[model samples]
Target: MFFTPFFKMLLHKKYILYLRVFTSLVINRTFIPMTRRFLWLLTCCIVLLSACDKRMVTADNPPETNNPTTGAPPISDKKVQAGVQGIVTDANNDPLAGARVVCGDQNTITDQYGAFRFQEVNMTEAAAVVTVQKAGYFNGIRTFRVTAPGRDQFVQVQLLPKTTAGTFDATAGGVVAASNAQFIFVPNQVLDAANKPYKGQATLSYAFINPESNDFADIMPGDLRAVNDKNELVALQSFGMMALELQGATGEKLHPDGTNSVTFRMVIPATLRKTAPAVIPLWHFNESTGLWEQEGSAEKMGDSYVGTVKHFSFWNCDAQFPMVNFKAVFKDDKNNPLAYTAIQLTRNNNSSSYGYTDEAGEVSGLVPANEQVTISVKDQCGKIIFSKNAGPWSTDANAGTFNVSIDPDARLALSGKVTTCDGAAVTKGLVNIQVNGVHYETAIQNGNYATSILRCATGAATVVLNPIDETADKMSTSTFQLAPGNYTRDLQACDVIQVSTISLLLEGQTTTFTSPADSVLFTSYRSDTSTVSIYSLSAAQKTPGGLIRINIQLSGIQTGPSVSRYFTVAMNDGTYFSESLNITITRTGIAGEYLEGTFSGNVQKIPGNTTAPVSGSFKVRIE
Candidate 1:
């Protein structure tokens, strides 16, 4: 048997190409397109095909003398070969076994080493999907194209770990009912799905309602945070949530039921006089019933006392009841030492007759019954720049201290220029001589300018200063980083920024201004306030196996009263998010103090106040 020259070229290359060869039958001559050296491969195909059909082909070299009755032989005489190898792992890098590997109907299971092999298989025609499965872990599926024959069988496929369902119950004496404290919850709600239980860090929020309208009027000064299972720190609202220190493991969970422990900050109620009349309600999350219910009223818990003790209030009262002396401490977010700036204590939104802060930032006032109060902090402009309201509080039998925090209107302090030299600020742009890593950016404004960077992380920032008018000219640049404390810098007044001549050092190095005269005094800062997200428990995603439920407590510091409300959260690109949730804030009671509380109500079928809950979810993105 023999082969023609045309069939040899197509078989050697990686592709299964066909060649058209011409032949003259009458003259008994075939004109092949290729040379004899290339026909060597077709020569072999003819030899093999001759065993099946002798007349199909003829080759340049004659077959063994014993068998020679053949024309040109056929193609496709043998099989193509390749090897398949890969590794299997879990999402956390744990080795996986029993994974099924298959190619062309040939299959094998992964050994203890998570390695598999499928030998002697044809791979030229198609691809296959290798699937790994375990009873408690999420299944892993990967596709591989059987492109060529090989001996290596080591590819890697990682399966996501499965999460076990857990529960959160308030009955263990750990989950507390909201007293008078307003909640200022932490913003992170991401449950680590890689572990058995989903764990997250959140802030607690408490609020107070107006007796007449039941709307938000005040809140606490600081909120407590539980990070891991141990270290705890009180955080200031609108402060950088970035450096928030935690007290505990903040163990994870996929749902409410999966949580084993949680942390919150509660408040002690103000002291009540013998003649005062008021009712305080305490609220807690009912994990079993999927609702929020009162732990017990202040009266029912025996927390109320009608006897007269030295009042914390500094002033003398008209009634025979003792005047208790009380003090209020003020601190900024980040839990740092700060001067309690002057503030106005507004009564029912009317500022004409309210009390003002004393020398120590304390407001001395008297309340006959339970009260929800507001302390509005003033800025240099003499305007009420930041004001927070507490949820609700009823005076009890004792007096100690009440905290009033002034939350700034905008937690952001910006001093950077509006634009850079390039089209916009890019990675490592330069202003003057510094390079800053920017974390926050506003939406693209007009074609000329951009919004200031808001809630940016801790870092230096540099913006390019391209001239807007000339487009080709470069303007002088500015760069700076904002520290945690109050920043006071003079603003630089300038026209359009030119990009033609500015170069900022972006290598993340340091610069020493040998002479102060050469340094530019640009007043810019980047202190951003972080958000603590509060989410609705109604539609939170359940554990995949339907085993755990999640219950969250909103906790935080407040003024005399808290701003009670609901909140929502969603990922940057997640299609589904949260709806409005209901929050109930009550005054705090002294720790280890038990009260025989009573149920006194202005209980209506509908709570009178419904305001949008404070945005509590913290977000970290580089802008």
Candidate 2:
């Protein structure tokens, strides 16, 4: 056995060279061994040295800090936390709202603008994987590298619509074909959730992803990174890919039994047919990890590659290539970091990977080593803003900072102030702006908002602004047309009338209450039930000292007028309840709109106590 100190000494280049010379002398019999034990030790050292020399550490393939047996990266002891922001869109570039997005153990749903954000997320590797799922669409995924903790990384995902390829009876399996992809199922092999053979009909939802497509980078799952059978991380050059899902008649997931396999075939794109390899590895995407794992192999036969898979998800026929870490930063002409911009790197084989710059305008990933590549920056509309040919780099490299000029006609700068109908500043809110189908949102701080957007050319653009007030739980929308240039506007949230007043007469004394100070809320739960609440607090009182609240519950109300059956008044004096209350909902608005109504009633101090007159009128917006 080799001692630890001796093994460490042999790791040095000089020591290794000395050992090689000593071994040569021993083999040539020029140096006589003192003992048989010495000869055996030399033999062991020679074997170990030969094994070390097998891993050539050249300029192209630098020494890796990885396990010798498994090519996996060393496990880090430091915990890393990062911030992530992203958007999910469909094939038409339309924002997909309500999509479920998952990153690590944290998950969130996209807002109406198709945007989601995670303030702080734990990251185990240098990269983060985000997955998105929506009804009627295939899963969308993105894997991007991060530089450090507390930095925000952005990614854009586009989901493909799941198209029905064909259907077949599980008992009588058949083939399903879509575009240039095909799936062959075996009879009595399909299993449902319960691990039992499914005898009913099975519907296949499939999508064939062409590497030559313009949106390939946006719609493709992961970053084309995979773990091979040897546990080595490598980049993939795809000839083509196919995503498939099998579902039972009741929309339950179904898959082929492990005992039998399903054959899948994908036709190589015309552009990549010449470079397609005779035999390539087959990789299936692991949605949970957002990484591809090699499972089988496919052999190129004529124009198509055929392989068999035990299950169904996303399968690719890709040629694996060794990679080196690469990084680059982008800036505008004025030397400002271009945050959240789209960047693409295309290999000589036409296979490309895309990523977005972080808040610092930096992007890092693994790229094929010692190969010429073309790097380009694209706008949100998928238009290339800048492109250049770079590298044949050997080892890990930083391409340095790139500066690009933005076309004046494609630049938009907007600044605005948000206010309530009373002209008071909105302290806590968000301003969501949509221009030419792309959404950009900024927080409203101190009632002011500002953002600059870069996009493709549009002669005249229509801009829509949706401002939300969180304090009052109100939202309003406005739209206008403008040309690319810097503009400022002060917006008033008038969609929900802000001025609401209520007058109450009790014991021959009339008290007036106004909103914007007192709280007036209108909530419509369903078509039949609604609620109007008015809460008032005295400035000099603390806690529950001087508080008054009135709750009115209305039933059988629609968009028009209706009467309420329940009303309650809670104050410092006592609690009063009333059964007969008249509430007229003059107008009921839809989403992002307002609700206006008025109420009047008489309440008793208690259910069967002295009566008091209570009448109030309110025209307030629903929160």
Candidate 3:
């Protein structure tokens, strides 16, 4: 141990330079005399210095870590893949085909059944936002939690039609009322599309959504989930909601300036009036994010909740509640997944939320925490297929799989083949079925259609089938009374007509309209005369000061198909009218059922002497 202190010094990383100098002196025989013990000690010191260097290097650069079981990177660091599927419908619960749906970076269009799916979407957040857009309706949005990876969630969005409530001049703002909702606009507060002050006549379109309505679950924008002022996701109990929009005289979009606020008064439903909070948070729908964000607060005055907003879109008076993630899977008695089925969750306070099952029969969303809720699965006909009480979960949890036993006597399966008038298979079509006042629709594939319906009624069930042939543009109607069981039948698109469609071509543009979005009337007079009136008002013309209006009036003596009659076209509140022209009238084989025809002529603007050539076709149901 002659060089014990020197060995210790060499082991210290900070003394490496001194160790190098000592080793160099020893090698040159200047620091110490040569000896076997000294050489051995030098060897030991070198070994210890190497070991200390290795320890410092290891501390700076550690080995890569792996999962103990998988021997790969941890799963928590990887991106998760989840899927979403759903349906889009109108306020009447009718499917909206060709609607555009978007979620995150994925986008798709709805099929004939209003169904859409996005598979294997990359998700990194706890929730996902979905938005739906279709012409002639307001935008539909939903935000739900993505509870698990590799799982598909379903959402149903119902779009409300855009309707004008009232109008006022932008220079002298006034009040407008729609149903139980009232709006107050301040003078010189309206801004046009360019964000400049607008001085023209303004049209106000509004809709007051009553949360107690049967269609509230479908018609509401979101699942009552919102982000509070603290940026925390929470559930909401809505008192009422109002959707508003303002447009200038020439159809330019308008909104209130940031410096000025618009006053809103929403009447709470009688059922919820007693429980309505005196002051509640006001949230506005964010179209880009498809989520509601807290903006301000509203106060209750009598039966109405009044609030002021800086701009316009959708405003709601809602009370917030703590929430936790909920998930479950549903299966039939045979262990088959109950895919694309409706599921509803009703809170103890009567407030409700809804979701649909995906292809795997799985549904997930945020629910109120520590509260009792009743979950019900319903068939297309609105019959409850299964019901159960689910608990007050204090944390995120899955309720596991639920097996539903459907009564065989309550199930109705219908399968059939559809053909065109010439006995050719109708490749593209729709099978619309109506039972017990509820409508169900399915797409036709290669002339074959099949669907299962669940009915709770006993005895014979009355069913109405309306098959449409897209290939030949034809349709047929049939009714049957049968017991609840599987049945096979064939349908032909022949004489029975049940459609109201019209198309007008003026100049180089074609404007096509379809009912029940448009109004087409067929009135028969007692004097052996009949008249067909077709009226279509665009979204702009639904308000005052709108300049464009399309109307067609047909009148003639009693005549059948292929007979040409006199008709006139009017525009802009009869400011312009077409000179008398020839139009053919045809009965659709069934008396008092429908009228079909075509027309071509010139429309002249009164006092201006401007005439435009117009041609169009129509197929209208008799009223």
For TM-score, candidate 1 versus 3, the one ahead is 3
- Candidate 1 weakest ten by summed lDDT: 234-243
Model 1 error, position 14 (Å): 88
Position 377, candidate 3: lDDT: 89
Highest TM-score, which number? 2
Local accuracy of candidate 3 as per-residue lDDT tens digits, 1-623: 88787657757655555345434433343222355325433443443344333321122333223111222211122345676777787777866766777886545556455666664465544546788887667778876656467666667788888789878777755656566765666556677766666888999878878888776766777677777777766788888887888888988888776545666667789899899998999998766544567888887766667677777888888999998878899877756566657788989988988877765677777778998899998875677779999988999879999988877676767788999888888899887765532345667889988766655455676677888887676777788887787788788876544556767777567766565444344322211111232221111122334233344444442344332333344344546445655566654433225667777778675768888788877776643
Question: lDDT tens string, model 1, 1-623?
Answer: 24455356336532132111101111122221244323332332332233223221123322223111133211122334444444455544444555555544344445444545432344431223344555544334332223234322223455443332222221111111233211111112112333222233322221322112201111111111101111111110110000011121353222111112122212222332222223332232211111122222222112221111110000011111111112344434432212213334444423111222221223333322243446555432244555665423344222323342323332233333334434353323222211121112222123223222122233433332221222323233233444322333222223433111111111232122111112111111111122332211111121232211111123232213232232222222332122333333232222111111111111111122332222221111001
lDDT (Cα atoms) of all candidates against the true structure: 0.27, 0.69, 0.66
- Global CA lDDT of candidate 2, please? 0.69
TM-scores, all models, native as reference: 0.20, 0.61, 0.55
* Model 2: per-residue Cα lDDT over 56-159, one tens digit each: 22334333332122444322334477878777888887777767778864565565556676655666555578889888999898876776677778888989
Itemize residue pairs with steric clashes in candidate 3: none
The prediction achieving the highest lDDT against the true structure is 2
Residue pair clashes in candidate 2: none
Clash number by candidate, in order: 155, 0, 0
